[model samples]
Target: MKDKKPRVAIQGIRASFHEEAAFIHFGEDIQTIECSSFKQTFEALQNKEADYVVMAIENSIAGSILPNYSLMMSYNFPVVGEVYLPIQLHLLALPGVKFEDVKYVTSHPIAIRQCIDFFDEYPHLKVVESSDTAACAKRIREEELTDTVAIANTLAAKLYGLDIMERRIESNKKNFTRFLILTHHENVEKKDIDKASLCFQVSNQVGALAKVLQIFAEQNINMSKIQSMPVLGKRNEYNFYVDVEWDNTKQYDTAIRQVLKYTHNFNILGEYQRHEDEFVQNEREQKFRAQEKITRKYINVKKIVK
Candidate 1:
């Protein structure tokens, strides 16, 4: 019998970054199920409507997607793979539309924020926020809004039959969104795995957090990223999410055993093959030493913050 194409669920319509990441990881031969929200994507997996989900976990400029982290914890899906999609925002408009004809611009709020510097030059143009970037472009095409342009990607421009008025419109050209490929079933590929993600809580005592990190350091494990989030209803307590990498499988095993000694409410999120080499990872990092930047503050956070 011929095999059924893998049904992959994404958080936005086709041509959105989520769909791009899905195709990047699973190949274009698979079927994509569009979801209106992140929760819907997870529900699709839970309901067996999709074999896997491609969800963005973090951005280089915006940082980690906290809600998706909560979703990760809530669903307990196995992250079997990861793909990094470069966020290249663009000004998409209908054919023959000019910047002077634009009365308003719209996109996902996050996408708008990334292009703040671009809009700062043209205060006359009103900014409208929407749920999805690709949807904004789709709406402009479907409705033929000649006076409005959408801040989306080239894929959206192509799919919507719109023209790109401005390319690479993001504030930081080095921005990238790290997406995790999750599945309902566990993948036991220990020999091929080199990286893992986990969330754990350490005691308030001195060196509580240090002890767990020390174990990883001693075991020669490379910690790629670490972020903290307050434990809901637990005053002064926080949960730490970490991504660690190792060259030797034995080293990672030893580190996990050692980590369990000094942590509580610990959960191994996923173990999968590392996506890129050290050089590619280094290239993704932004260097701020020579450049001036504004301070970013987090006013409020949910139980899961990354």
Candidate 2:
């Protein structure tokens, strides 16, 4: 007998980047519950409508997703793992529609911003901001808008049956997004822990934050990320969110003890294994390369019969 697949909730439709990250983490065995927004994604998890939630935390080009950090502080969900997914934006439109046919381009504002350089060459095309990248693609297909194109991932294009007019159209080729796998606090396990997401606040004094960081340095714990979010309704006060990595559990435990002495409202959000980038890339790229290899074999056929 086999175990039942987990139901993962994501913000957007089937072909969004969140869904892509979920598949990367859980493989193709899990079921996805699409939520309209990040808040809805958390609500689905809180209501037990999903076994886990895939949330994008940050992007290399856009920096931190501050809203998501705020959501994590409010929900206090356990961060079980993370996945860094490379983003590839494409220009997609209805079949047989050429570049001359496009009058407007629609996508999420962030997606539009990433391709600003490309759009500069074609000043005639109007860029319209939309809710979600995949949603924009969906709109074009459902409304039969032949004059508008979408800027989205290849997955969205394939899902909406849109032809990709251009590939890798993003201004920066190094764009990647980091997504967090979240679960209820009680369900979180400390086994195989190497990376942790923590939140705390230091007393409003000079050198206070530096002392907390020094403790991590002394204990041999590496600080991978540190972001500060303002404490709501508090003037000039903030809550710091930090991600740390450690090779030894004992070192992390000792560091926490020292860190606690200098911080306020300290919270161990979650401690989980640091997902390797190579593993995710190998699994994802292999499938893509295999398909491409098959296509190339037919297109460039010169068999050797020795």
Question: Candidate 2: misplaced stretches above 4 Å?
Answer: 279-306
How far in Å is the alpha carbon of 172 misplaced in model 1? 0.7
Task: Put down candidate 1 lDDT per residue, 49-115, tens digits, no spaces.
Answer: 9889999989888888998888999999988888878889999999999889999999988898899
Candidate 2 lDDT by residue in tens digits, 169-281? 99998788899999877667778889999999998999999999999999989898999988999987999999998998899999999888999899988889988786456
Candidate 1 matches the true fold with a TM-score of 0.89
TM-score of each: 0.89, 0.88
Show how many residue pairs clash in every candidate, following the order shown: 0, 0
Each model's lDDT: 0.87, 0.89
